[model samples]
Target: MAAGNDTRITEPTAAAGRRGVLLGAASLLAGAALPFRRARAQDAKVNMRISWWGSDDRHQRTLKMIKLWESRNPGATMAAQYGGLIGYQDKLSTEFAGRNAPDVMQIADNRESLIASGRLMLLDPYIASGQLNLADANKSVLETVKVGGKLYSIPWGLAGGCFFFDTKVFADTGVELPGLGWNWDDFAAAARKISKAAPKGMYGSADIWAPAGTRAFYPFEFFLRGRGKTAFTEAGKLNFGANELTEWLSFWDGLRREGAVPPAEVTALENGYETSPIIAGRSAMYPINSSIASSLQGLSKNKLVVGTIPSGLGSKALPATQYGAFINTSMQVYVNAATKFPKQSIEFVNMITNDPEFAKIQLMSRGVSLSSKMAALVTPDIAPIEQSMVQMVQYVQEHATPLYVPWPKAGSQIQDLMQRTHQQVAFGQASVAQAVTRFIDEAGQIME
Candidate 1:
């Protein structure tokens, strides 16, 4: 099968089993295969380094954007250091501790840990000085990146949770595309049906509860938020107890038993979009954010589309979805406080985020255009896949709720616990009850 053949996967599950064999990183390094860097205009007046991890497309586009920036800026230059999830955080932390961190750092799923470093350059001064443009940016979205009334990061774009489905797989399976406001029941049913219709060894869905990289695509947290619950409080304590964990884990466990999701033995840990079960055609649906539209679609020949994640509206007693105008989009672009080129670094960030030309060049690669003006400029000319990303962002923005509570810095550790507990259950090392207790106990430790 081709890269995006949809129904039949060319690469066997055997290959995917190795993608997560090592200590993979997070969503920021989603599509990385190796660590690499490019130093542009090494002799320029101002040579600044920016560190980020992203898919191949993201890296290419970002490098292109930097190239454009340098052309116009003349003396200022860029050193783009980036790669896959492996060693990303370790390398970043090492640099920060050494007080030689990159001028601009794009912290992804595990941004809070870095933000807690207390060494990131405060962006407030730049905003106040009119060096950074925010007059047209979303106020609510901007608020998500602040800590203690100080701005530490600027969002490249905005994104919300959504399911990325292979249209070809759905067509082949004769399963209807997921309808708006679909719930857990509907999702499970569709998964089972798709599995039955798919080729042998393929599942309706990947084991979503399993570890992807080190962090991001937090289904458990998102599930709880949809039902008006928090996994952890602001102070870093487990908000809801074992009952919530039991409920969520049990559902995925049941799916594993029903062939709706991959079994533990064959469930390959998703290393990145390039190696995921969905991209390989081994699964039909994968929960992803709207921001991945371009990168993911570009890798697969199968037609891919994004939609709102399942909701509990009209069915459950609590809230329905975790749609927010500013979901994970504020992954936070931080400047190193110790950097010498504070002015240049902030300007580069402002250019990438606020400039019309860069925004159009990037499209939905980073995410939905950051400002309304950017959106208007890009929406009319965006590709079909990008259009869906934009639409998903709009839908979430319109129906967002105030119930969302931000996770603490320990959020990533808790996510690791979730993955560990999931493995225990899937491998039958521990029952759901045992996993719940362990998760709660371990998560509390992480919080404190």
Candidate 2:
């Protein structure tokens, strides 16, 4: 959708104005150091600050794990910082610039800038010293935390993107459940048929009209992969041709225009996995990270099933890895570049990553456990969300191809542009040709 046109969609309203201010103030105090006065005075203790973004359940579980860590290792105290996702990047960047960043911070997808700016410590020496073992982690994840042959992070979990559908809903519409090797055309045809047959209030698919990296982007990425083209070169240049992207955008636009997908007005209020259309049983299919399926299942009364995202009509399955949790040298207990306690920090990191019990507690909160040994420890005791995640990971590893390491820089922006183009085309603000032309021109500038 055009930038201004988005106003018509009724963006998710901000939290009540006064309440938001109070929460913001509370967050500032909680996120900063004043509240940790007692812990700070223990000069001989190892005091670390760890920050991450998550739901209340994650925060509670992680804090419990911190308490466990402290009990097992006396004289160790960790200050916790947690927040919602919206402004996490800004908060972390500010902390880094102020040189008061937490000893352990959760790294987001923007690792390239963190590494390039020399803000992250190189973890190679620690890894070589047997501090952590990531040999069994997904290769794409390993590469995400590496720069110029040096290890700067360790993967925390495994993740993959897949299609989620309500089988009963599809069956009710007389549509066949998608099977292996169905391509985009097959999906489109099925969507059209399903829409025609579905109950009046239902849609065949949730409209994910946003560009790449937004939940809608994965299907397009899979399409590109099926064609054997990477989105970018190793040196970080845009790689797809105009025609290829335009055609893909057009397909998505067509779905929205034909009402095969939910309207943008409805989709605007939904985030990935939480989109109202899917949760409300108004849509039959959604594409999202496999890990999110459990949460979706809990929120809905319907029976949700997982399957491969459709490729081209009649094309074989072409799977891609979703995001993985990798260690961020800047966020974890990195040995300060000038610290006298590098060994201690390294040991702490090793304990966190390689310890089976610790890894199980971390679980899907960080993503999926990176070590094969740690992964084996995943039991029913882990949160149901995480247990489902483990099953999803195993399924993906069995069915999907390993994804190439994503380009470290400009990746988010590239994804943003793709989503924007998709939205514009879907809203009829721009034709597929116009959207692609603008996207390529903008992407070329940003990637350079």
Candidate 3:
């Protein structure tokens, strides 16, 4: 979609200059503001550098979207730097430290840190000016990305946790595919049954909750939240106690001992979506981020279907509409607060997020549209997998609790500690009790 008619590269207004002076370069710089002082004074073209981490599919589509934006607005040029998620944060952090960060970026794990350090440009002004249309945004979803009462980022799409299963594998093993109401106990039992029935080399599931791998804390966080607690609070403290952590570790250990999941050797080799055991046919089900359903479907030969994660069973009281999973931003887009052309950057993000045609091209590659208007506009054109993601998200929104806060600033460090602690237990380097105790101690130190 085209942005506003104000496409000209005009001089900063006298008031804008005064506001910039009031904001102070150092303050802006701390927020990772664009260091446009390095640019030659005579340069007129409004060029912006945008960065994100993603697969080739996402890279190509984002470039195409950028091209579309440029075509609609003359005199604006957007250059992109894209790569995988690993090291993306370090790269962005170094750039920000050097005052050479991109004008726009997709911030994930580093979000809380960036916001806490004043590194992200507050989108409040643009939202107030109606430059970035958030009226269609889910208020609760929008609120999750806010830091200290100001919106720092805008989510790309909506997604929740989903168990993406291979129907063919379950059929072959004579195991029934799990339904929506299945509990953790049922999940483990089905896994064992399927593992016994399958070919000798294949297991029923991957150690998706494997601590040494990607988003290792997701399942643990899910478990905690399912039990009516959270891993961390809005105050950024570790919310669950040591005893709870022990139970989480012990449960995974049980799954491992029962041969319900792939062996450590197989899980240890996991790199990402491409190297996932599901793609390699080493397992029947994979816990996906719910947004990547289309990518998983593209990679697997079996008929892939999306289902809910295990519920609380009858052990704990649940809300009348409760489901175990929660909706979260798959990723978020934000503009540099210090960009010379904040209006242009915000407009670009607005089009990418709220424009109907852009949504169709994206096709929930990120996740389902969080905007009601965009979701409705693109509904007819999305792929079946994308449709399933939207449907599953709708189900969760109506039936599940939403994560109340963005991961804390220390989230990545906490996740690392959790992964290593679990890996120690998984590899027999430490007892579950030892691992849990160590994690609690280390985590307290990190959060402190």
TM-score of each: 0.84, 0.78, 0.86
Model 1 spans with C-alpha error above 4 angstroms: 1-44, 213-217, 315-326
Q: lDDT, candidate 1, residue 190?
A: 88
**How would you order the candidates by lDDT, starting with the best?**
3, 1, 2
Question: lDDT per residue, candidate 2, 1-448, as tens digits?
Answer: 6865665443433436667798999999888886588675766657777777655655776788788878887887778888765677788778877877767566655656777788777888766766666566566546644567677766545556656778788878788887645566677777888888987767887766521113455556666665666566778887678877877776777787787887766666565455456687778877666544445666777777766656553432223233221121122233334333455556656766677767666665555666676777765556554555565556545544444545658886777777778777766788889888898889879877
> Judged by TM-score, which candidate is best?
3
lDDT of 2: 0.64
What lDDT tens digits, residue by residue, belong to model 1 across residues 1-448?
4547643453555466556553365544774634332333344378889988777888888888999989988877889999965678888888877888899987755666666767778888889999998887877767656765567887888876677888999999999998646667788888999999989977887776534522323556666667676666666677777776787778888999999988877664566667777787788887766667788888889898877676655434223545322365634578888888888898888887789889878887778866888888888877888787777777766665655456688777777777788889999999999988888788767776
Candidate 3 ranges with C-alpha deviation above 4 Å: 1-39, 210-214, 315-322
lDDT of 3 by residue, 33-134 (tens): 445554566687899999998777777888888888888888889999999877887898888888888999986576777777777788888888888898
Best by lDDT: 3
lDDT of each: 0.74, 0.64, 0.77
The whole-model C-alpha lDDT of candidate 3 against the native structure comes to 0.77
Q: Write out the backbone clash pairs for model 1.
A: 4-301, 4-302, 25-214
